[model samples]
Target: MTNVKLLLSAHRRFNDLLSALALSADIQPFLAKVIAAVEEFLPDSKVTILILNQETNTLHSGAKNNLPDFYNEAIEGVEIGASIGSCGAAAYLNKTVIVENINSHPNWHSLLPLTQKANLHSCWAVPICNSSNDVIGTFAIYHHQPKTPTAVEHEIVNVAALITSVAIEKRELEEKLRFNASHDELTGLFNRAYLNNVGDSFISLCIRNNLNCSILFLDLNKFKRVNDVFGHKRGDKLLCQIANIIQQQTRSSDIAVRFGGDEFIIIMENSNDLDGEKVARRIHQLILESVSNEILALDFGVSIGVAMLNNKPQSLSQLISRADQAMYIAKRSNLGIYCKP
Candidate 1:
């Protein structure tokens, strides 16, 4: 196909992808679409999108097909550097990288065997950057023959990278907004909003599956004094520490929430009343120890209440009400942990 015609065709596909992005809830489908578009425009080529993981400083395969499984697995978590193959080098330099002959390119020296096994001979890649100019991923094309990218191929790569960047930024922004809506900004724990949304449905699932569950309602004993003595900043720090402890103690199936100021709730799945009390005591003791060790001048304690799901079907609100009552009783009676009858 002529370069002008190919460019026009790719532009139309790019526009279609942008429109689809408006309806895309996740970034994966959009990324797949971008890859498909590139493969469609450039026949006998395989494309892969590698997303950068900021925390790990590594590149992960976000979308790819038609590549050999062994080749994909071999480079699954490849690190980005100046000479780590076409995709890695493109991501590291934040620029376009083209290797006309993979067998002779220094960047592909280490991966040459794998590429040969996969019948890949040439590669070209461009970094996909967000609006802030931060490199988020790379758009790469591989060929079975040792061939350089033509003008048309360059246009296709540019269009695909631009479309992918927009899709990723949109998906990430949506995820952040959704998280803020359901999470406590101060503690980064699930908030009352999330609990209100999922509580009844979760309880119903527990009942239908015949799984035991319990609620642990916790209230800080002297949180007000801490805020009055030390500042709100210190109080926030303490709260974060407590939230971390709660998250660490609970299983992945458990739901831990910062219900409100100085109050927290933990929904334990597959746990009975006795196990609930045990977990409550453990958390209480850990918080006590944390405060005593971290801040020697201040005295802090936590009162926890445990409520178990009985044979009678009940809503999450009912379980929480029972646990709240038990917590107040514990606070009033100076009992560190209490279970509602």
Candidate 2:
């Protein structure tokens, strides 16, 4: 009868963990709850989740329960290696690593000081793999006395690792989709949709803060001719190059967008006419130099128009119209850049 009650309780705990994992958008909080659930089933044990950073080839603590701050800090950013310790080795090998006795295990020799400080006597780690079967992290349990996991505990840890991998992969996919919707694929700059969605908010911010703001509208001169002569591939390369120049000349607070084909817009926050004109002149000069250098077989230039927000424009469309009108004037006068009169 007692065994039946214990099984029912463990089943309920796992069900709650699954519900939490399915509902949470973030991985850290889900992992924190996972450690708590594990503690409930297997008392007197500490749990931690470590994620592998591919760029650095290092492991970082993603979540933990009942572990000392000093211990976490010491093991943070641990480089993955065969002999580094249970979690590091499990991630490196893409397999489970069990150290029944921390004092005698050779893999834990260097990390003994940390375990001793935390009073941890043994550890078992399982690698968490994504849908592609690529190991992305590790789930580890540390006991207060020398021991190995029972069959039930081992099974529980494996299920937890699987759930963690699914949650992480889902979060990554959502982020990628969001980025794709907001950015231009060719130049990786914000697209017109993003500008259309956020323009009103930006104007409100400028008005509330009483800060100067300006916009620069630019169109590539004779871009159609270049596309016709050099082919579409080379035209795309040139546009990408121009995008880099615009990014370089703008401040971090500025919003640079690929407004449309052969057209770009720079929204300069906390900037006046002087600031906007300075950027326009720099862009004009860079385009002229690029053309003079004969980097490409054809002529390349840009006509720029600047609009200042000092007069407090009634709407974003009005400001954009003013800049567009100025651009046409610059084109008519054969001037590379012009400011609103």
Candidate 3:
């Protein structure tokens, strides 16, 4: 093909690949297709995509084409630094990194053995950034022979990186929206909507596995009085404190939900009524101590009701209703109590 024709063909392929990536719901398959497209455009090069993990400050392999498994393993989770390999440095600097001769480059000193084993001699990487210009990943093309990327090859890498950034940002925003929909804004606990949506499935799972599960329903005592006297700000703070205490008292398997107003629910998997009561008591004790010590001796307490799955053997709504009724009983008694249903 003529040079102009080749350029036109590459642009068409790039557009087609970007369209496919944009419509993909999952990142893995999108990345796989991206690397494949890169390999097709640069037949002599191996393409790999690495995504930045902010929590670990490392680059993780997202996709690879024409690369050995051992080479991929060697570069996985590589910490980003000034002296790290092309992808790591590009991600850290938020810019393109071109290493024409990997064998002689100081940046690839640590990765030289792996690259030599894989017969890779050159690497060019472009940093992938989101709309906010935050670098999220790297798109790298490695050559078996020592050579710098041609102008057209550089254009292709840059466009691929841009496409990747758009896809990642879109996915992240979708995840954030989903999280906000199901979580309480104040206490960061699962909201009532989330609890209602999953409660039935959780109950069915417990029943099918013949496992014991319990629900602890909690209601803050005289919470309106606190808001009236202490202002809504203080009341909000107190609720947050209570939520933290409940979370601390519950196990990792428990699903804690802020079930509207001053009410909360905890679904304890593989737990009996006794276990639910223990958690309730611990939460009450912690709240009493926290409110007394931190909030100027304010009168804050919770009335808890415990219900076991085996005891109820009914719908989740019935269990919650029984627990709610039990909570009212505890509230009327004016005692630090956990009633069973």
Tell me, by lDDT, which candidate is best: 1
Task: Rank candidates, lDDT, best first.
Answer: 1, 2, 3
Question: What would the per-residue lDDT of candidate 2 be over residues 1-341, giving only the tens digit for each residue?
Answer: 35456556766776776787677777777777778877877789888888899889799887766798999899899999888799989999999999999999999998888889899999999998889999888999999899998777787788778877878788888898899799888987889999889887787788788888888999988898787876899889888988888988888778889999999988888545498889889988886676634533455668999888875554677778888888988887889888996
Q: Is candidate 1 or candidate 2 better by lDDT?
A: 1
* Least well predicted 10-residue stretch by lDDT in candidate 1: 292-301
- Give each model's whole-structure lDDT: 0.89, 0.84, 0.82
Residue 73 in model 2: lDDT:
90
TM-score of 2: 0.83
- In candidate 1, position 149 carries an lDDT of 84
Better of 1 and 2 by TM-score: 1
Task: Name the Cα RMSD for model 2.
Answer: 3.4
TM-score of 1: 0.87
What does each candidate score in C-alpha RMSD? 2.8, 3.4, 2.9
Model 1 CA deviation exceeding 4 Å by range: 26-29, 150-152, 202-212, 269-272, 292-296, 310-314
